[model samples]
Target: MARAPWEGDFPDVFVNCKWKSPDAKIICLADHGLYDAAKGQRDMDAALGLLDDIVLEKTVSKLRGLERQYGVKPKLIAPAAQVSESNNALAIGYANWLGHELGWPVDENIFQMKDFSKDKLNGWVRIAHRSTFYGEIDKKTPYVIVDDVITLGGTLADLRSFILGKGGRVIGMSTIASRDGNDVRIRLDTDTQAKLEKSYGSDLAKFCHELLGFDHRGFTDPEADRVLSCSGYVDLRKKIVRGRNEGDASRSKKQAAR
Candidate 1:
């Protein structure tokens, strides 16, 4: 609930990005669990698995346990990811599970990661584990970007650059859980804004949620403690992203046919 960069007059989920649009499109969803990332350890999952930890990958399992015990499913039951895998795999895994649970087709695509050319910027830009990608983002394909957990959202920023850079737009974004803390400023880049004007002829954020529903879960203080009580911490952000690069390869296939 930090003060957003673009607060008034923006549609449902639009905001501003200092680097890009005066009006950017920003959306948010929460991570499914919580973990204390090890200091000096860039590896989120591995760090959590070390000695002196408690693991709580069964947030959903506990909910399921409660549901079976009580005989009814909660309307918004979000589960924690049990393993640290690639981002694509994590997303597909979640989508597959959701499909099984909801009985629908769920597909996902991740942004490609590319190192910025030294020619493009001054000194080393603070590239998160996730970096901006160069590629095409298209649709009629049903997919959402997924991550195990969302924090400062370096990945989301990378995604925004990729999707907009390719004359495409974000349908929606999904995640397992979040740190429950962020100060993101959302806005549409020039490319995304132009695409919005061409495709919808109106505001993009107003219709995004209607087209692709937000799938996410919030961490309660108790649930947070329960999760942190365990030693299995998994930041799988980069690894999860590495998994999705394969899916994005097909973009060239589609573009070739175009």
Candidate 2:
């Protein structure tokens, strides 16, 4: 598991923005080309780096529509934190292009403040080792988040939380692509929350606070669903604990190699 040089070597810091109501609108231009490519014989390298001018144009076009629909002009565009397998900040390229095309300034201040990588991890492991961000945000400005793709939306949720925590308002998010049937909304619904509480009882909140560094309400819809899918709270705890141990060992090995 290679880590980015810029990724910090510290504890994970989870931010609970309590994002609810008026779900943040997402403008996804296409389905994730990479995943689609993996299913058959297709090349998606250019798409991954936002090097395809057609895709870029399409993304910008949709963003324009979003602007008109929302009637809010974003002062800045910030890319969600994502370090690729080759140690590249993938979303930054897309964000820069979007900013240039949309006449918005690109904000690169928010970034990963931990040495965690999401590549090839299962859902539970990914949730256990969620990325943390650190930086200054312009509190007075309305912002838009940009990312190459949306999976479970944990990354974008964290980015939104960081901006909201810094007193900045994120008007919306624009992604190049998204998984089919995936909802962009991050807030867990009442029904889902009720189910989670029923399964885990009050221990759910304590578990989230102690392990993930947030209250249970901080969970995104997908994250809460994943948690609820566990057989029981003990099973969930064991999985998280094992994931954390594995992560710690990997980081330790990397440090020793350095």
Candidate 3:
């Protein structure tokens, strides 16, 4: 059998983005599944179709609702267009779709990523190399950053900080999914957090925050332990394999009963 695209050279998951504290203003249509599906299949058209059919209209509704609730009109910000890769292409398509629906001009090329590949660890989000956003981003204007997924949230954090530094305000962030859980709080209990903090020292705890938008409180004990042990990358493949095994076991049990 052919291996899934996610099972390629890099581990399917890794900590890349810095965390931005969870806020209520942001509206995500779906979770990270959209990103995975798009990248796995290497098909931007199908991904955009899913986003358009299942997520786009609803996303617009949510945006209108947010406008009504906050009285703060939001503009869309996305990573610059990179048509070569599947995920970047999806980002571009999403931005264009949302821009067209709302009649809001998208600052599509506001930020240009120096590196093409996303699998790198250290320079995943190079703030220093990022050129100043040439587009007109009115000061204090509320902007919502869009992405396919929010795993570690390092990229979003970097984007938020960059916008803020440039005199723009980031009211919220929207993405297809949250890597660990949809909620933006610490998932770990107090005792577990304390244990991991003591065992791994303060850096790991900081990493938990930098990688995800939440602090150490967001991780469960097992999750924290997994972070510590996965040294090179966040090994979500284990979770996937374990889930498959459980599913197979469940089917076997059911068949036996029959």
Give the best candidate by lDDT. Answer: 2
Error of 2 at 70 (Å): 5.4
Q: Over the stretch 1-258, how does candidate 2's per-residue lDDT look in tens digits?
A: 111111121112111111122333422333333433321222335334333432445446656765686676675444444333124433565566667667777887777654545555666666777666777888876777766556666676677777777777766666545454222555566677789899888887777878887767767667788888789978888988887777777667766766
List the candidates ranked by lDDT, beginning with the highest: 2, 3, 1
Error of 2 at 199 (Å): 2.5
Q: Which order, best to worst by TM-score?
A: 2, 3, 1
Q: Which residue pairs show backbone clashes in model 2? A: none
Instruction: Encode model 1's per-residue lDDT on 25-62: one tens digit a residue.
Output: 42222111222232122334432332112212343243
Cα distance off (Å), candidate 1, residue 123 = 17
Candidate 3 runs further than 4 Å off: 1-47, 56-59, 81-87, 119-136, 179-258
| lDDT at residue 167 of model 1 (Cα atoms) | 50
- The per-model lDDT (C-alpha) reads 0.32, 0.58, 0.48
Residues 1-258 of candidate 3 have per-residue lDDT tens digits of 110111012112111222222543433333334545554554667567656643534456655665676686677786553443224555556656666776655665466442333333222222112222334465755776666655444455556556665677665555544543243321344565667667667666455445443455434333455555543324433442454455445446655755
RMSD for each model, in Å, please?
17.5, 9.9, 14.7
- Estimate TM-scores for all models: 0.32, 0.70, 0.49
State the number of backbone clashes in model 3: 15
Q: How well does candidate 3 score on lDDT at residue 187? A: 31
Worst 10 residues of 2 by lDDT: 2-11
